[model samples]
Target: MEFTQLLERRRQRWTRFALLFTLFLVFISGLYLVVGEVFISPLEELSALEEQLILQLRLPRLLAALAVGASLAVSGAVLQVLLGNVLAEPGVLGISGGASVLMVLVLFFAPALATPFGFMLAAVIGALAFTILLVFIAKSMCLTTTRLLLVGVALGILSGAVVTWAFYFSDDLSLRQLMYWLMGSIGAASWYHHLLSLILLPVLIWLCCKGSLLDKLMMGEQHAKQLGVDVDQARWQLICAVSILVGGAVALGGVIGFVGLVVPHLLRLALGSENRYLLPISALAGAILVVLADLIARTALDSAELPLGVVTTSIGAPIFIWMLVSHHDSR
Candidate 1:
């Protein structure tokens, strides 16, 4: 009887999550179809330009937002579990910063190789460098959660300084390009950006399935190993996956911040920290959040669009500070 009741409760819990996911899916559809400067009313007839605008511009951009948001959120959740730190994330942990810095260097120094494909490669290389270093240090040094966070932050700061330094030597045109990229726009979103998201889908599935192992790791490395988990292998797999996913996001969206930090954190607070649910739900919620943020970025002002990064940071900063304060209080 108890076992039956437990199964029933699990069913009900999953049902609730399914409903929330559906609602968010509907929200994203609404944003994608109708929520822009020139609304494409589903019920109304459209002109050629209007149809072209939706197909050529808005649709791709919305898809890009969804892809970037989901990738970052999943990466963040995985990192939080892998490191056992609420604050560990792709952006805050220097994955995005690393990508940004290397992409900048490539753009400035190797103009011939600074094409979209080349930049993506550089971003991946940079992201891998930092993520691998962190994973290595954490495993080798047995760093505390707080110490790990500090090291990540220090790496991010160093990356930021390099990105800033690149600005000084760049010409007017390059400066304009760099500034736009740094500000994080979906303005360049295209059908090619879809490729990045498609590559990440299998990776996200793998990470979600590893939730059980992560749960075991929460008990400690020894506990996870004793439970038959290959602790080192799983950890390295997760690190590589995060670097690829986060680097793809940066390559597609240009160093957009805080989606990783905010989405997983917020979902954990609302839905509890069960990785099975948290991982997938965070992906959906992240899609909704970024799509909505992009809508606001486009429609917020009379003549100019806000940077998507700025919108995210404005929301994420306060929540992040609250987490820090609460964490301190608990300690």
Candidate 2:
């Protein structure tokens, strides 16, 4: 009987994995169809144009979508574990807002500093600064999730206000650049972006996997301390890991939201709350969501592509609301 039960459990796990993998494959195939003109009757005759579209447009956008999705998902998973809150994400924690504010400032004051590397540096610095502030607030306020969230929300509002004021006073040329960047696009992606994301993503993944030790810490600080976990050290390391991942993502994709929050929660529901599975699963799920969303963003309208951020928000918000309602009904 025990052996039979074990077999059933393993089968169930594999079934879920297979489902997620199948979804990913379908998303990829759909993206190819939409972006490659494979389904468009008139465009099917134009082989050269199809090749150009696939090579010049679809591939880079897909890569950017993958990077942004994985980063946000991992970052969200880390934050949720660290704070013991289901809703915690990089954006909610003011990390993304902080990065945005700094990038806007750079654009306003020194337009020449708007390169990818420069924007990445500014984003990292901003995320790190806000993370430090959050730590201080959490420690001083007894480290409750509610307090942490409230503080983060306040900081996010402040950062947004700063960005708004800067935009109000900025010149038209820089403002146009800033506006486009804020809208978020994979249209500007290049081999350089792909290479940089490839380098940084693995490092962040490794660090986040290491920091998955925090899932144990989340059981309760007292229990974690008894288990020999260095609570404070683990917290700091996790914060740094999330900062790098979220900052790099925002710098690359410009404030795409909700993938992190939604993907991790969905994975947690499927795979349980063990960060070991949760982190990697969320990463894959996130990559799939972004890639599919980008595909729709490019093709859902006419010749004009929609902003990737707008696409994510439109899709994610409804799903998020449904999740909330379902959870409430279950309770």
Candidate 3:
């Protein structure tokens, strides 16, 4: 009878998960059809101009946004689990900032190599450097997740300084490009850019397979090891996977922040901290949020498109403050 009940519960859980995923997919498809400077309806379409706009432009941009969103959210979920911090996110922890700095340098100093592939490589190197530093500092100082966030902020500040200096010496065109990149815009997305990040979907699957290990790690390093998980190996693999994910994401969509932090935290709050479910669900939710945000960014104003980061940060900042306050009150 106990086994029967357990199986029934598992079936229910899967049903709910499937519904959630399907709802998001529907929203994405619906939004893709109607969002932009022009309105498109899936119900009726027979214009070559509309066909060109939808197929040539909007589809690639939407796909890139989806890929970037999923990558950032899953990376955020993994980092939060690894660090035991709900607030752990690539943008918040300087991973994206580090990548941004490298991208700027490459754009100015090596314009010939400033292709999508080139930027992806540069961003990966930068993200990996920050991730390594983060792991080293956490281990050496034995810092709690909350305190480690301060270190993350310091790294962000350092990256900001570099970006500022780069801006000071750059030309007008360079400055404009840098500003757009830093603020996050998917306006320039193409099929190649989408592929650059979407190709890393396998890495996401590999991370999902490690969900059990991450759940164990949440108990503590010693506890994880006792559970037969290789703590060191898991940590390296998780961080490296995240760096690759973030690198590709930032290369495709620039340094969009808070999707990672907000999506996972919201999921854990609504459901439970089951890493097995949280990671993939968070990926889907993140994709939905980014697509919705992009739609708003493009259509919110008549004269100008808002920065993608601006929309996300505007929405996320309040939730972030609420989380901090909730943490404080709980303490």
Candidate 4:
């Protein structure tokens, strides 16, 4: 049948895209490891100093970039489908805000616990607490989608207020460190952060598998119900999954923006909104973007490093504006 042939062609196209994406990811990852302030040749043997730089300094940072990027992108993709809004992303849910508040508190009151591992733990705890609050409020009040979004906004605002007060009270040294963190950076990343990836990997796989559920939900609640989907349970399942994914990412890399917001939208535009393709490809694309952005952040300035979030926002904001203008023109 002609219909079957059309499906086959579409499948082939996506297969090609996936293959190309994988190759591109590999290339950039290698580039990230080799090209930094001190460039080392991958083809040739390295000095002891080069080996230390690559192993101790760059490798851990590279891994963090990949994990954080992939996690944020997949989280964003799932969120857009769940909220039925193309603009929805992990930050809009207040998960990152919660993580930020806790991280600030640790730095302000308990600087002794402000080590890299300690901050990551604080972030995860804060994100998990906020997620629980959102779930409870949503379940008890029986909130509609718009109402739920407003609740999340309100929570984010509350967290921001608390952080502002902390800023007002903190001394000069803490303030500088806090500002750097708020802007986001993986320059301090260490091998211990790799433990967070154990949490990230399983969640990523689970979310990628939920593409079928997302497709069913896309049609509308009643339609999804007719398709034997339990709408309530699926919604909660997705919320919890997104909470963990976003939490782990924030914990690992601070509040790096735009990766979650822009990566999925770009993929959807290019590949179509089929969650099966969109979810996995978003992960790959997100990893590539973060790795490349980190590369730029470190090497862009000779004396001082750029913030990771600043680099991503600088790159993503323009593309986002163009996307908005293009959508308006199309309409």
Candidate 5:
């Protein structure tokens, strides 16, 4: 019963952490709104100009940060289970690459489809297509571990090649725009873009609720089958859900890397890979991370904002390297 007590205490601690994290998310979100170029106090009555800035600019950007963060984190958590790799994330696995390629093509060649709704739609299609291809290739070849990661890396490289070619032929104006986006920023976010992204909320909820299914999948296919799970059907469903999440995030935030890779991995380490805890916590932590990153991106320099990706990469890369080293040492 000592073991049981230990488990119970651990659960209690995590429950407290989750509650604190939720409040932290709210606090940071409020902080994000008021702490920009013109600091607005929460207690003070808003001026018309302050109202416009908060509602039109800060609010929407905050929403985008929340959505992108939660989506990528949850997707990473699920992909880690599905691929059986701590390293699986939207960017690393080329899911974001797929969405990026389509977005670039559309913005360059079919500029008419560059609207908020159109870009979202294109990104979903691209992500879904690439996810389907990934699943098919993995299944046909029975890819596991290193082979699967190599395949994902290869896919990412191919997408990069296509995007590079597009960049080569683009005009200077278009090239500049694409470069900024590829580096990732929510500085241009507006209500319309956030609204388009919100449509993915239901899908995100559905994914978070799949914790039990992921728990089963984590045990391997034959074992999951023994437990009456339709492993193939479930795999496809999870893949599709991840595609939508990754696509929506890429559409809204442009290829913000490492939120996915880092958040869930950290949570799994702390929370012991019990996905019901891991997934939801991952979402909250991811949202907090991105919002904070966005805040730093905009406020770090008086004259100019940094790219969102640059901030996250700077933060995530060292942790990622640490993870690599720790994993190797453990092995």
Candidate 6:
């Protein structure tokens, strides 16, 4: 790359970063205002309680939401590139289902192991296992995009069946806990969850960004091999990165879906499909969406808080429908 080209790339990246930063600030302000109304005790006491709520309660949830959303979104972007399919995501690829299945198992047989680290570990293992399974199938079958999606759908159904069985066999308390987690919420967000996710997300993002060899692989494995890109190694590394990002988010927030799928696709549509730009931009957009969704989940009703998954799906489904229709019309 020439110096001028590099300068132009840097300028473009900074521009995207600035836009993302502005959106992030707007999201935080909106979340603060919405949460201020819910948690502050009285109108006169608003200022003091707003700070308290932001620091003690809402801030942790917001940070958690940001981490989960960013991780999922970036992971999805990488998956899209790696699989050469716009629809590939942790949720669609059965990674989230894998994590959910593991968590459900823990809730059933080992309720005492329901700590954050335990859940996160289980989620990572489950995600990696399923990812390996998918890779094996892909390689063995010379998988096309459609075939990969079909395989993922099959894995998702299998994981869901396992989860259902666990729920059926569990005690009422365990079942209730599993159900709530599956529905997904930022309600349980705490400093511990925030710190755990914070540690993993940044490192994973760094790894993904550094994997600019991804651009070579995106041209197709045969071409990547010809260009000395170590195709299988790159694929493995990408899978591990995606596993960590998706597994960590699911463990922390309990299977919040669609942000991963929607954010990156939208970013690609707006900014083109380069992973370097797509990764960070989609991360920021995902964080903004999730924080806003959290605000809605908390305050959209009179007394009861709604599940975060419900809010995301409500928003995501329409956007998905629009994308499908638009694609069809374009074709």
TM agreement with the true structure for every prediction: 0.93, 0.84, 0.94, 0.87, 0.94, 0.87
Q: For model 3, state the Cα shift of residue 192 in Å.
A: 2.0
Query: By summed lDDT, which 10 consecutive residues of candidate 6 come out lowest?
Result: 33-42
At residue 299, candidate 1 shows an lDDT of: 88
User: Candidate 1's residue-wise lDDT over 285-310, tens digit each?
Assistant: 77777887787788899788899988
Per-residue lDDT tens digits for candidate 3, residues 117-172, read 89988998899999889878877888876788889988988998998888887678
lDDT of 6 by residue, 163-199 (tens): 8777777678857766776777878888878656766
**Best-matching candidate per lDDT:** 5
lDDT at 68, model 1: 84
Q: Which residue ranges in model 4 land beyond 4 Å of their true spot?
A: 106-122, 128-158, 172-175, 324-331
lDDT winner between candidates 1 and 5: 5
RMSD of each: 2.0, 3.5, 1.9, 3.3, 1.9, 3.3
Clashing pairs in 1: none
Q: On a 0 to 1 TM-score scale, where does candidate 6 land against the true structure?
A: 0.87
Give the residue spans of candidate 3 off by over 4 A.
1-11, 172-175
* Cα lDDT of model 2 by residue, 1-331, tens digit: 9999986886578468847766775668455545533454444565776767666766676777788888888888887777666767777677888988888887767779978887887887788888778767766767655567678878888987888787777678757666666666676787677765965678567854764486677788888898889988988877887777777887888877778888888877766776766677677778888887777777787767788888887877887677756755664
Q: Lowest summed-lDDT stretch of 10 residues in model 4?
A: 84-93
For model 2, the stretches where C-alpha displacement exceeds 4 angstroms are 1-19, 22-30, 33-48, 143-147, 319-331
- lDDT of all predictions: 0.81, 0.75, 0.85, 0.82, 0.87, 0.77
Q: Is candidate 2 or candidate 3 better by TM-score?
A: 3
TM-score-better candidate, 5 vs 6: 5
lDDT tens string, model 4, 1-331?
9999987887787788889989999999899889977889988999999999989999999999999899899988887776665755666667788988988888878989977667767887787778668767766887765677678778888887888788877678857676686777888788887888887899899998989899999999899999999998998788777777777787777778778879999888777888887888889889999999999999999999999989998988787667656755664
